[model samples]
Target: MVSEKENAHFSELEKLVESIKQRQQVVIFPPGIASFIAVNILLIASFITFFAPVMTIIGDDWEMSQKAGGQFLVILLAVICIVPPAILITRGKKNLQRWFILLSSALAFMAALMVVVGLTMNNEAIAYQSPPLYVCIITSSLAAFLAQTSHYKTLTLFYYLLHKHE
Candidate 1:
């Protein structure tokens, strides 16, 4: 019951799948890795630039920007590094982890935006102050988030659609 056209289609699908499997060994780069790295660097720089200077300028009463507080940023960055590699190692089709990666990337992007905003502020008296840095941080963050989320969602949806009948 197989026509030539159907057989040709099957052959093409087979070749596509094989090609994908072959390329799976390539080191796939995630879109958000740069953002994560930038965030980490900015966090350290902010601690030094904003916090240290503020402390020296105003003494005990003036606290550092609490936006990049605690080990959360570190943990987030580690996750950013770890998750993509794990997915790449295991291949990116594992549904749960794939979703996790997308969600985590979104969070990190948002955090970076917050940090960028915190850094650009001219206010020394406001808690979580908003400054001109808000513009770049927020704009970049929004762009990063939108691109990663869109790519992730599109890939996930495509995979599900492809396998839906099975």
Candidate 2:
């Protein structure tokens, strides 16, 4: 039912698809290393963010403590977002990197939003002036980006090595 040209075109398409399937079958590394490193950096950043001077109002003074309560809650929220995915990644569950990538991106977004909202509420012009705010935003964003591209990074490395002779 097809012309000779059509038959040759379909054969070329089939070869390309088969090549992709072979590339995918070449799995040399364990999947979680990139995610693990990203999570480690995130954990450290979250710790620093929690203890940063964003809570300047926290003190023996009742009013100051009360005012800082909101800041404390924001830090808690950031930590909560940080910890669960770290736990999930560290637990070594199958296919958890996919979930970790989603969580990492969400954490980055949430942390950035928290920084923006806090800066706006405090009338601060620059997030960089606030250690916790900017650090959380920057580190979470970096970690999310790394987590998302980990697969391609790993695959690209191995693919290069495998085909370098060709």
Candidate 3:
């Protein structure tokens, strides 16, 4: 006992839903592209940081490795951070835009945590004899900044799509 008008209305509703899905595919591009760019920047920074001095012990000719301090840990962490972006760039699902946003936020939080911890660490003695804290601070700060920017932009656009009420 279905009316022709009711059936047509259902058909139209399906089309609207399908159209929104298609548009979402286009909307997800910016965040994914940003992830790709982040991977490249992190890789380059990690390389330069490896050889950079972490600390220089004073008055001691005693041999010490420059790569044995917080910088080493920071560089390793930076490398791990790059892997997520690479995976996202190559295999991100269109339906997982919200998941992408969460991942980005988590990445940003991790980096920001590193920066905060670095700022609060007892670096008075360490700073005199070790590599610059600025390297760890700068590298972590950069990653956090990029991820947060991506999160903000993607979230703004994700919620911008609207359905007509008229």
Candidate 4:
């Protein structure tokens, strides 16, 4: 009953879904490599964001109490968002890749909370600064989401590669 065009469209949709499902496939990698990659990116980004600006502000005679707290907030956000997922991935936790994407979203929400608190309580007009409050929020959210999802994806791929032994 399906028209030729409808059949082709259905076929394309099927392929797309399969591709998404493939994200769940766990492929094997050298031990520690996956975690190393993920953690290094996170740590490097955190260090750059934290010390670089704070040091710059210090060198430029900016108020230490004013900027230090905001920098601390930013680093705290990064750590909270990054560390749990990294630990989960590194430890090879079961179903981590399957569920932690959603789980770490809680950390993302917490990171957002820090930004809001920073803006309100810090008395430094922390919102809408360059890189902006919202952008920082979005960046932290994206990092947390990506870390958990990618770790999950990597685990899935790793499982698929190991399936033959079972």
Candidate 5:
């Protein structure tokens, strides 16, 4: 027969496993505003990447080299914006949340840096204002915030599960 201490330990282990299973199903912002905004931003970024070449061709002002460079930049931005959310949707791995946070923070930082550079550079080509600049800043900021929250939640849950019985 199992002693009282052994039975209690087994019960605690079972509870811990159950808690982990439940937490795995708990997503931070499913079908929520944060996720909606992130998805829309990602879609917009993709659309821009897809149509940028067409826009460059239709508009004669941009030279071939500039058009190519712009297209490359758009593609890079699209990928950076896409990866985190895609991972969250596909894998939902908790340890990878730090990467999402970093990517989103980088996007937000790039947006802010663009604004600062435009304001300080005093160059007409770079100083022009666009609505998408604000959109990028806002969306990236939201994504970063959401990712951070998810990371913290995961950590808290992990720690609770590990130490609650002690």
Candidate 6:
């Protein structure tokens, strides 16, 4: 026969398990469709950025090789900030949404840094690009915020689902 204290402990444990099971059923906000679209846009932008340099090189414009090389490096940085999140989302790994947020944040930071650098250098070409860069920064920041919020909600649900009493 179970002792009184043992029975009480078992009861408490049962309640805890039940609570976790209930939490496991909690509704999570699915990843925002808008954020997914924004990620795609970022990916596309990175691709465009990447190809811009290649196109210049192919144009037999040797004079702009230095500029093209710099653009290529920037494009590579953008790819670093974009591709992983796209892959994670495409694979339906909601648990990794935080990576989306981090990548988006990095993109936004890079855009802002580009703006600052352009202003500091007073380069007309860079200044001309600032408006588009600003737009990108805004969208990327929005995507990051959405991804972070969704990730937390999903994380809670994921935790409970994994820990639910079987």
* Winning candidate number (lDDT): 6
Could you estimate the TM-score for every candidate? 0.31, 0.44, 0.36, 0.36, 0.51, 0.49
Best by TM-score: 5
Residue-level lDDT of model 1, residues 13-119, one tens digit each, is: 44555555567533233643443344334333333333333334344443455433423454455456444643442343536434444444454454455455446
User: On residues 115-137, what C-alpha lDDT tens digit does candidate 5 reach at each position?
Assistant: 67767877443345434555666
**Candidate 3 CA-lDDT value:** 0.45
Encode model 2's per-residue lDDT on 36-74: one tens digit a residue. 565657745754563443444343345756756766776
Q: Which 10 consecutive positions of candidate 3 have the poorest summed lDDT?
A: 157-166
- Single out the weakest 10-residue window by summed lDDT for candidate 1: 46-55
lDDT tens digits, residues 1-166, model 3? 8699856855664465457656742334566466546635744463344324322323134344533554566566656645554444344222333443444445445434444554578545444423343454455346545544645334323333222221
**C-alpha local distance difference test of each model:** 0.43, 0.55, 0.45, 0.49, 0.55, 0.59
Which candidate, 1 or 5, would have the higher lDDT against the true structure? 5
Query: What residue pairs clash in candidate 2, if any at all?
Result: none
lDDT at position 114, candidate 6: 71
Pitting candidate 5 against candidate 6, the one with the higher TM-score is 5
Candidate 1, residue 124: the lDDT equals: 50
- Model 1, global lDDT: 0.43
**Alpha carbon deviation, residue 36, candidate 5 (Å):** 8.7
**Candidate 4 residue 68 C-alpha distance from true site, Å:** 12
- Per-residue lDDT of 79 in model 1: 53
List ranges where model 4 is wrong by over 4 Å: 1-92, 98-104, 118-122, 125-136, 147-151, 160-166
- Candidate 5 deviant stretches above 4 angstroms: 1-73, 88-92, 150-166
lDDT of 4 by residue, 14-47 (tens): 4544554568544244543554455336443534
How high is the lDDT of residue 52 in model 6? 47
- What are the C-alpha RMSDs, in order, of all predicted structures? 9.8, 10.7, 11.0, 10.4, 9.6, 9.7
